[model samples]
Target: MSLATTKTSKIDRLAELTAKKETSSGASLWREAFRRLRGSKMAIIGAIVIAAFVVVAIVGPWLAPYAPTAQTWRGEVFANQGRFVGARGENLFGLDHLGRDMFSRMLVGARQTLLVGVVSMLIGLVLGALVGVVSGAAATLGGRAGQRLDDVVMRVTDIMLALPSLLLAVSVAAVLGQSLTTVMIAVGVVQIPIFARLLRGSMLAQGGKDYVLAARSLGIRKRRIVLTQIMPNSLSPVIVQATLSLATAIIEAAALSYLGLGNPDPAVPEWGVMLSQAQRFFDNAPMMSMYPAVAIIVTALGFTLLGEAMREALDPKLRG
Candidate 1:
């Protein structure tokens, strides 16, 4: 065989091997993360619990046998009025003070709880990301101006962080008055500092990396580099933090509601409101509090577990 032909054959063979290697090791980051998540039993359990809550939130009212607000009298009381009864055939979870079905109220409350959690999370994520991205990008300005901008933004975040999250949320809720919207806004505002600080730190760390420097050397637009390259790379931690923050938002909303700072209308069913009302009947019907409290604990646990598992999966240092 000619020397040139032999060299061409060797080149073709090397190309084939490279293609095979690429095919064998070409999984995307998300796909790898998912594979790691699937290997985690806690993650699977958390996912199942979260899915159940989502299903309950979506179809709970339809699944309930009784109207959340309808009253059913049992024993006769003063002036021929019948007193409320506990659990019965028609009412699986039993009756509240006014003879309202506990199970039905709980079902409706699930929808409210999930709605507040999701909406508040979205609000926090959007506002926080914007603040963090802007603050981080400002560092590119360099010199005294950059330092001043960073100091100003970070001081504002520090001021917010100085207060306890719950206290801040309570203050906002009080100002907004008692309503679901108030609870959501309060919780969302509380979350802003946390996400902003986390994302700002992430972006700052990424800004000093080789890839960012390379992009700068290529003369990429400052905005484009920040948005497209730096932001996307820094989002893994933010996404994990978001999942954890969702659980916190849910708990905070419930707390505000329990304080009578949420949905003033007594007829409205919400986990926190239900817990507040259940206080009156605690002696006779402790299950009222039990149900709502258990629901809150389980939901929070699910989110916590899921967030931890995601962190483990996504972090290279944690991967086995």
Candidate 2:
């Protein structure tokens, strides 16, 4: 063939390859996962719930009709006789034992509740991810010495995991004493082992993949290979774990608060604290407890649903 004809044929082949790549089902892992996530009913519902919750957390305090700590209708509530005022024209959610407006308290408390969950989860994620990276790096790239280091780290995480999560949180709270910081630290500590173990295992799996071997063969630096290749591939599980951890962190934080280890200020309304105090008059004022309990459940469920949806989307096995 003539030289000009051969050059034209090569250009046509290149165009064909580019077209095939463009028409592939997934553009990239994250984009494809997001596409799948958008189609999931559970994800849609969870996203809506979480969005509403975040809005409330951000503005609920400002929008509250009355001061959350105010006993505006003290005389109206007769908790001893189970005669607290039901939902009235003024107090939409009725009055608590102390005649505080349930609606107002619920609104103001949302910020604190979300703060505890997000901050505690971040605590676990940062510290746990740090440990996992160190351990996984040593095991994959450090030769025999690295393997031993990994063994020790894994053993420590195993010990932490052996204990019941709630019991560990309670123990931490007791040692730290009663405070909002104590509750966040306690709940966050419980998640460390879980996130650490998950990330480490994911890295180990990814370390043996074909791309890692190819990177090694290409004379890529160890640090570069781990950071650019293995680390990114290993993050899917960690991301999913972070989502799931948010749900558990909220529940555990609430449990600590209910146990009287959460924020020392009684005037501040925390959902868990509200639930704890409402039990005193639960027989008559079920609405007080119901309000917080339902809020907690719905919030946790939203995170759980979103986490589950993410796990499915990120799983290569689930890909078509």
Q: What is the C-alpha RMSD of each candidate to the true structure, in Å?
A: 13.1, 12.3
Residues 87-159, model 2: lDDT tens digits: 8798899888888889999999999999999999998988888898888888988799999999999888777
Off by over 4 Å in 1: 1-27, 74-84, 140-143
Q: TM-score of predicted model 1?
A: 0.87
| TM-score against native, each model | 0.87, 0.89
Query: Lowest-scoring 10 consecutive residues by lDDT in candidate 2?
Result: 14-23
Colliding pairs, model 1: none
Candidate with best lDDT? 2
Residue 94 error, candidate 2, Å? 0.5
Per-residue lDDT for 16-105 in model 1, tens only? 221110112576556777898999998998899899999999999999877887765423222234333557787787777777788999
How displaced is residue 192 in candidate 1, in Å? Answer: 0.2
Best model per TM-score: 2
